[model samples]
Target chain A: MSAQISFRNLTLGYERHPAVHHLSGEVKQGALLAICGANGAGKSTLLKGIGGALKPLGGSIDRHGLDPREIAYLPQGAEIDRSFPIHVYDMVSMGLWRRAGLFGGIGRADRTKIEHAIAAVGLEGFETRPIGTLSGGQMQRTLFARLLLQDARVILLDEPFTALDAKTVSDLVDLVRRWHGEKRTVIAVLHDFDLVRATFPETLLLARTPVAWGPTAEALGPENLLKARRLGESWRDDALPCSDAA
Target chain B: MSLFDTFFAPFAEFEFMRRALAGVFALSLGAGPVGAFLMLRRMSLTGDAMAHAILPGAAIGFLFAGLNLYAMTAGGLAAGLLVAVGAGVVARATGMKEDASLAAFYLISLALGVLIVSLRGSNVDLLHVLFGTVLGIDDATLMLIAGITTVTLLTLAVVWRPLVLECVDPTFLASVSRSGGVSHIAFLSLVVLNLVGGFHALGTLLSVGLMMLPAATARFFVRDLTALVTTSTLIAFGSGVAGLLVSYHLGTPSGPSIILVAGLAYAGAVILGPIGGLAGRFVPRRHLEA
Candidate 1:
């Protein structure tokens, strides 16, 4: 499989402190990967680096030729104002924004596509309802519908199933599987080991740096998990200044 | 007094009153929606700050051109934008909050503006700039207000979706489009532009009152952006008419009267509106069966 994203010694951080420390890895095209780690393991930061929301502190993230707009990224807790007065349909229609643009009104075909995406998430009746009024499950489903319309080659989901019911998780996981089956790259920051093991073919364990990167079964060994837990606890405030080549 | 005589006769009797109504209407048509967005973005107070931010420039313009409309408008726009951009840059570079930076800058701007105005003009002239003379609006002021309204409405039409998307989900837009930062800066500029426009008729202090009061009023009764903007505009225009009539009948300051009317509407919405009104709590309906 072709390398969809090649990270060459990428060091992403904030204010000179590395959130995702010096790391190098490639996510192959059409690979479904799970990034698993403890709290503050830089999973979301790594996803942000790929999504181009955060610039790498040192090295480059090579997306080959994928435009930033061509990547569908859902951040953890998604900085969305729940009280914003937007209808579910209007919010879903924003998925086609890459094609529709600022002034391009949604055409009849686009409208149908939005409706179909909404229905696929089983939110058909909630089209006109304000997104604020929806339950967390319904909101997640709405986001999944938006992901469906995005049709990106690479999909990055940051804890997409957090606090969601089992049913909603299964339904969204199915969508992730569908994307994987369609030869699209899907990277998710997931905590649930069972879901990660069952759905994700590749796993990258992170603890501010890469702990393991390989097949799910091998990378998630008990020893590796213990080491990751240890590494997470050892965050040093007076750590040696990062050498450029490190 | 009949309805026709009470409502329509004031304007028929005075050209100044007609011009004032026209100016306020145009202002309501533009600033109302702009204010609605400001309130939605939770930058309602930012609009208030920006109003003061434009003061030094307008005062400097007054000092230079002796109340020349174009000079004052240009000067105010420049000052407002300067404070807005400066505050943003300061907040980002120095790690201070934007509101903190803005408050500091606008305070300085306000003091400088008052000093400048007082250097060249009498207390009456200062009062004119501070409180405005809406009933004494010239043709040039009318045209300027109308032109600002037109530009604002047209710009809103073009940037509506991105603006809304930007407000609700800033991170999402960044992933999908590179226009996220651009939209935010553009929205900030629009707020400044509308504030400057409002300054022409309502003056520095009372200008933002028109923008924010109606928006707050609309918020109580409306749930969607379109409805929020529409209702705010209607409320603002209605306040303009009613307030102008009240000012005419009772001989009050037109600017304050208009703002007071909008404030009354806001209070009314809070007390009486159906969505989340105070009255609804006292007069309860049975819970919905979901």
Candidate 2:
């Protein structure tokens, strides 16, 4: 597969301390990859960097030709205001923003597409309901519907299955598989090793630095897992700045 | 016959009353939706701060031009925009939150404005700037209010989709479109423009009252933003007419009367509105059969 995204010595962080430190890797087109890491493992940070939400503090992320907006990114614990007075249909339709744009009314075709997307996510009857009234899982489903409408070549899911019920998780996972079947690059930050092993062909283990990268089985080897655990991501504020970070 | 005279006569018998009614009507039309948007953004306090931020600019205009409508409008617009844009800039550059920066700017603005107004003008002039004369509104001021209202409503319509998207799911909007920040800045500019328009009749202190009170009142009654904006505008409009009549009869201050009417509606909505008002909270409802 040709490289869709290539990171060259990328360093991403808040303030000056690097959370995703000295990473060099490539996400090939159609690669189904899992990013496994501890709580502060810079998994979300890396996703943000690639999703264009966060600018790289150092190095470069070469996306070849993909526009950052074209990459559908789902951040964990979505930054949406739940109390915002928007209906599910309206919220889901916003996924077509890349195409419809500002002042571009959702045409009949777009409405049909939105309805299909909503039904796909099992939110058919709840289209008119306000998003504020939705439960956590239902809200997640709504967002997934939006993601489905995004129609991007690359999809990044940060802790996609967090706090979801078993049924919901399985359904969302099937959707992810559907995206994979379409030959789209799917990168997910996952905690469930079982799910990763079963679904993902490739894995990148991070611990403020790369622990291992390659085939899921090898990358998540017991020794590498132990090394990742030992390389705790806590910041030592007084520690001298690393010269190689540049 | 007397009842008709009480309400209709005041509006018909005198031109000033007619102008005041027209001024407040235009204000209600524009300020209502603008205020509703402000409330939705959870920037109600930001609206208040911006109102004060415009005071000094308007005051400076008063100092130089002596109550010239155009000069004060321009000054107030400049000042309000400066604070709004300045607060946003400071928050972005220095990592300080926008609210903190806004509060800082507005305090300075409010104090400086009062000082400037008091420097040359008498206590009555100071009072006039602080609490405007809705009844004394002239043709030029009426035109200013109407013009600002027209601009505000048109702009609101043009930016409605992006503006709503910007408020609801800003993160998603940012990922999908570049209109997030543009809509935000546009919304802020509208807020300042409405305040500048309102201050001419309601004064800086009470101007935001028209913008915020009706919006706040409408929240209890509606769940959808469209409904909220419409309801708020109607409430503002109702308050404008009612307050003018009350002022016409009671000899009370018109600006305060208008705001007080809005405040009353807000309080009543909080207690009685069906959505989430205290009464609804206490009153038991039949459970939804799943």
Candidate 3:
């Protein structure tokens, strides 16, 4: 398969302290890739770099043919402010931002897509409810509906299933599978190993640097997992910078 | 006195009261929506800070033009924009929180403004700048207030979608389009412009009260953006009229009376409103169950 995204000696960090260092890999077209690591292992940071939310500290990220607007990124739930007075339908309609834009009217066809997306997420009757009034599961479903409407060729999810109940997880995992079936490139930062092993065909294990990459079973082997944990534990905040020439 | 004599008579009989009514009505039309966005964005205190930031420019205007409406308005707008942009820069460059930077800048503005006003102008001029001369508004000032209201409403409508997107999910907005930063700057400009308009009618200190109190009160009673803006405007207008009547009867200061009435409205909404009020705690909320 052709590469959808290629990272060459990429480094991403804050204040020049790399969270993801010297990462070189390619996410193939129509692949479901899971990024797994311990806390502070740069999973989310890597996703952010790919989503164009943050600039790389060093190296380059090449998107083969996809434009930046064709990528949909779902940030961690904690990053969103739910208390803002917005209806679930209005929030979901924001997925059409690329096509409709800020001032463009949502035509009848777009409205139908929005309604269908909402129903697909089992949130049909909750369309007009304020986002603040929804439960955690319901809110996640609402966001999933939005993602459905986004219909991006590349979807990046940052800890999408964290704090969700089992049923919600199963439902959202189904959606992720549907994305896979549609031949979209999907990259997700995930913590739960069982879920990742079961759902994602490709796995990248990282601990500030790539420990293993390739098929899920080999990349997440016991030896590689131990190496990742050791690397993560030995990391020092004030360590000297690694030589770029090396 | 009958209801007509108490409420309607003062506005009908006195030209000053009539002008004050027109001035506040115009102020509410713009300030209401602006303030609703402020509350939604959790920038209520930023609104307060920007209100103080306009002081030095209006003070400078007073020094040059001796209470000239056009001069004060222009000066206030300049000063407000300066502080807004300056605070944003400081926050970005230094990684300081925007609120901390805004507070620092506004404090300096307030001090400089007071010093400039007290340096040359009389106490009465300071009182007019600080408390406003709502009862003393002339045709020129009234027209300026109305003109600002028109501009504010139009600009708000134009930037409405992006601004709402910015407030709800800013990262999402940034991902989809380049209008996120533009929308933010535009929203801040609207806040400053409305504050400038409000300063002419209610003075710097109480102007934010006219904006924030009604907006906050409206939030307690409504769960949608349209309803919030509409309710806030109605609250502000009602407070303006009631405050004028109370001032007419009780011989209180007009601007303070108007703000006091708005404060009272907020308190009443907190107690009696259906959404999240004290009364709402006792009564089971049905709408939130979905």
Candidate 4:
């Protein structure tokens, strides 16, 4: 399945203030792309524009000849209410809602898909458990289960790892690499510089305005890295800079 | 008496008893399901608003239409829905908190209802509107209640899944845009209808109390959506029948009696439910697994 998405000079905003201005980019069919950005660089806004959750203030976003629903979007898991008394299985099953069609009951096939997705995410025994009971890592995996159930060729994740442990991060990175092996396009809004350099071949550096977009080796060099750090600190006014990117 | 005789007695009653029973069934049909949604949405206060807002509408309808139950009910429903939507819109536009807006709306509606009743010059009618009379129930009123309940229940059943989905994940659901604001509005409209239906049986205050108490009670015992709805309906039906019987046997007001029974169920659920905060005598082990 060929999955290609293009954002052509897209300007996104809420009300009159623009979040991402004059953005233009293209995701190669079945290519793994990482979006590296400073805080308030409108990475989430750009993703929302591309995902059809928010309409672009200007220009257009085209998903090659497929519907936007064919793309799986895993929003930052922090946005979800963890205290909600919903079972992990039920939460994952919602990803099939688009394909299952409105008013369509969950059948044998849907159940099989849900089970496979859960198992793939390594949540084998947590089907009956409430999502509120899960750890931060487990919650991320549950969201991954939802992404898996969508069965889309294109995956866009917004900060899938913020407070996860080291092992969970590695497991998630491995899952993304597996998706890459299967020729699925993975675009992630990530903060870890080392993870991007090691795992992602292509990187798009954003700092409100487009900073750079190309191979990680070229785009994430010391100068571009310095620029990102400066922009992030400029936004926060007190963000510390440490040489943590190995 | 056998179960058959007890159940069939309502059908075998004269005009007054027949009207009262019909009114109970009508009120339960809409009230039960609507209460379940309100409980899930954590907006049981909106149900309270609907019931309280109906007061002025009923008073005005009585003044203009001269005790015509249908006209008065129509007036109440229209006014209730209007105030409900108006409060919501005002809350959004002004950036005021919903709680503040609801409080303002509730007070205004209550005051307006009382003023209208006072202007109509009948303390007896006002008292009846406050605490309804089963003996005063008539056939036309019964038919109106039945028709309204059937429509609201059917509409609710049709939109049940999406409504539940919206309540569970409103952000994701709204992001997709498949679930629109229309469903929320429709659900609120259903709440208004249920409140209006119950208004005839239990009056305004007692009607809302009965509707909310049963569903809130049902939540502690049930985890699934279907079970919650079923439990709420059963609670409403049982209390309704029991209240009507007690009212007939003893000379107490049916409205308050039914609400009292419903309140008892709520208390029971709180005391004996799986998640109850009782002194841990029958408490289950931590059942939620990761």
Candidate 5:
């Protein structure tokens, strides 16, 4: 299968200070990849670079044949404002944003799709409830419903299971499996090594740079995990800028 | 005097009162929705900043046109847009918070506006500019306010979807489409336009009062965006009517009276509103137990 996404010597960071440095990798079509790392691992930064939310400070992120709109990105829950007065249905329907756009009407077919997505996430009666009234798990479910509606070729999930209840995590993990089964490229930043080992077929352990890559079992070995922790600990604010060469 | 006579007679008898009422009512219609969005985005104070940002522009217009409505409106729009866009750019480029940059710019703009107005116009003219001349509203100014209100409402309708998305989840909006940036700029422009409109009716210092007070009040009453906007507009309109009546009867300043009435409504909602109100807090945790 062709690579759906390729990062070549990519360095992404804020203010010329690299969070992710000289990372080179390819995500094959329909690959289910979990990115694991300790705190300050640049896992989220990698996702942001690929999702085109942040520009590459050095190098490039090539989106093979996929258009920018063909990718769906779910940022961390902290990035979303739950206090805003928005209905669950309305927020979920925003997944169709690329298709319906600013002024486009949501046709009956789209409405049906939206409804199906909401029902699929076990939020059947939450259509009219304001998002602020929802619990964290319910809100995550609503966001997943939105992602389902996105129906994109590449889906990037940043810390998808953080702070979620076990039931909600398992249910959303099932959806992720379903997406992989549907032959979509899925990349997620995860902290749970046990969950990654049990589910993800491929894993990338990163700490500012690639520590290991390949099958989950081989990539997440004890040595590589320890190295990732060491790399994170040694990272300093005044560290020398990373060069383009990997 | 009868209640009807006290409330209706002022508007019925005087052309100026009727015009003032119509001007502020239109202001309420547009300002309420924009203000609700501002509050939702946590940019309520940005509205205040933008209000001050328009002052130097309006004062420049006064200098050039000598109280000409068109000149002042155009100038205010220009200045307001400049400050808003400038603040946004500075925030993005330098990593400073938008509100901080907006504050810096607005304070400078305020000083410049006062200095410019004082250089050309008298203290009386300055008071008129700062406090507004709602009772003295002419047909041209009235038409301008109505026109701005119409444009604001229509633009809001067109950008409503993206605007809500941008407010609630800007990162998601950015991922989905390119219109997120467009929606933000368009929303800020609408805010500037409405502030200019309200400035004519309520003064630059108090224009945000008409937009933000009713919005803050409505939040206490409604959980849905549609209900919040509708309730806000109603509250603003009611405040306009009540403020006009009070001003007419007591011979108080119209603009301040209008804002004061809105403030009073906000206080009432905070105390007695069903949602998150102080009184609601006292209603007990029986449901929590259940």
Candidate 6:
């Protein structure tokens, strides 16, 4: 019952231009895959394409039997709306939006899940607080609470640790490890190389195209990293391989 | 007299008064929910533009059909929707902000409406187009209001969740739903319908104010969507009554008077609202926390 995602010749971006051109890749069921790239290198765009936010500019993407709703994506922490007054409990409950009947009302079981998700993210006491009051780290934790409530088999995190302190980052890493161990596919757009090596078993490096994708140890090795850095401009070609460079 | 007798006295006196009251309620019902979404989407001005853009449509309908209320109303709705969609497309195509485009559309429509009316054979109908003063409220107008409210409400009920999702977090909604794009289109269409229907009582110039101010006032007292919608409806209806009574006593136009009443409510909310930007300075943080 493992979840799998496949991208075939997928080119993603705006209607006028393509960002990730003709890139193909896959995440095996239950793999913690880190997507790392420089700014504007199509890391976020590729994640959005996989999560079905951006329709591919060319080719196709198939998520074998897995519903898009069953995929949870935590956009960059700062991108969330904090102004309108809403409590953490209700925010967490939104994960059940699709699961709630067409009329969209949450039931008792859904409430229990919301509470459990809040507890999972160590936000037990903060359930009723307005989401706007939360610190940057706390907001990220609340987002995690929401994702956990979704019970999605696939978790896509876009730089979830950007504004957090070092301690919070480690704690988040532990949570990702726990999720990975439980057979959930975790693909995150991460900037921190150390965190990626420590937590993720696989890595997908991109700079407008797939530069390297493989087991974490091989992909993050010194030789492969150098190749990835050098291939920054011409990464769209896809003719070169990290293994060959090594 | 009992409080009810005083407050509800106008309902008993004249048929026109009753129709006017009914018209207010119908307009509020559609405007309340539609306005809430507009505020959520930060497109309050879009409602403003739609309100104004309907002018030419109403004027044209009046010119061609000559006081045929239904035809005029239909013309206004068609023109309003056309301008709304056109503005959206122009914004998308040219990298222009929607509000900026809407402002241009409103000006063009308003001018065209005035120009068309000027060239027409009758100069008498111009009064209804601008002020919407009480000339003679007809059963047909009531029916029109009721029909418009029903359609707007039914469509809103179906698309409530998606529209809300789209407003609160479009990126998240896009990730979860298979048809996010479709839901967005439907949401905008409902807004257009609601604005077109409500355009009669408030006029295109002030319709957005009526829709927006009540909701803005309600936001001071309520946090959840259900409470917010209900409170806004009450505020709108109450303001409508106040405006109607003021106009009845002073012999002023109903539309402007009603808008002034709602504007006062907005001022009160802005001063006394829990998280009122200015009022926040005086109130303690714990008191304002939702």
lDDT per residue for candidate 5 within A1-246, as digits (tens), equals 899999988888877778888888899999999999987878888888888888998889999868776799989998888998889999999999888877889999999999999999999999999998899899999999999999999999999998989999999999999999999999999989999999999999999889999999999999998888888834467877554444
Q: Estimate, for each residue in A128-159, the C-alpha lDDT of model 4 and write its tens digit.
A: 88777789999999888887877788888999
DockQ of each: 0.84, 0.74, 0.68, 0.26, 0.81, 0.47
Candidate 6 segments exceeding 4 Å error = A1-3, A14-18, A58-60, A65-69, A233-246, B1-8, B89-97, B100-124, B282-290
DockQ-based CAPRI category assigned to the predicted complex of candidate 2: medium
In what order do the candidates fall by TM-score, top score first?
A: 2, 1, 5, 3, 6, 4
Which is the leading candidate under DockQ? 1
User: What C-alpha lDDT values do all the predictions have?
Assistant: 0.87, 0.89, 0.88, 0.77, 0.89, 0.76
lDDT (tens digit, per residue) of candidate 1 on A1-246: 989999898888777678887788899999999999998889999999999888888889999999877999887655898888899998888899888888887889998999999998889889999998988889989888998999899999989999999888888888889899999999999999999999998999999889999999989999999999988834567877787645
lDDT of 6 at A212: 80
Which one wins by TM-score: 1 or 3? 1
lDDT of 4 by residue, B1-290 (tens): 77656666655765676677768866876778888888778888878777778778877787787777877788788788887777777776676876688778867877977776677577636665677665577777677778888888788766765686677766566544464456777787787777776777777777887678888888777765677777888888888878877776676888888888888888888887774436345655665673
Which residue pairs in model 4 clash with each other? B56-B113
Would you give me the overall lDDT of model 1?
0.87
Error of 3 at B248 (Å): 2.1
Cα lDDT, model 5, residue B42: 94
**Candidate 2: residue pairs that collide:** none
Model 2: residues with Cα > 4 Å off, grouped in runs:
B1-3, B114-124
Evaluated on chain A only, model 2 obtains a TM-score of 0.97
lDDT string for model 2 (A124-156, tens) is 899989999998889999999999999999999
True contacts kept of each: 0.84, 0.71, 0.61, 0.06, 0.84, 0.47
Instruction: State candidate 5's TM-score.
Output: 0.96
> Per-residue lDDT for B1-290 in model 2, tens only?
48889779998888999999899999999999999988888899998889779888987887788878888899899999988887777886788977998899888877887776677665425466679889889988998899999999998887888888778777677777777666777788899998998988988889999989998898898888789999999999999999999888999999999999999998999999888899988989898986
lDDT of 6 by residue, A1-246 (tens): 344988888777764355786677677898889988777778888878778777776777889988776789888765566765567887777788668734867778778888988887778899878777888888888888878777788999999889789887877788888898898898999888988887877898887767789988888777777766775643334443333111
CAPRI docking class of candidate 5: high
Candidate 5 residue-wise lDDT, B87-204, digit = tens: 7778867889888988987788778877776776564365656888889999999999999999999999988987888889988877877776677788889899998998877898
- Give the TM-score, chain B only, in order for the candidates: 0.92, 0.93, 0.92, 0.87, 0.93, 0.87
**What TM-score does each of the candidates earn?**
0.96, 0.96, 0.95, 0.85, 0.96, 0.87
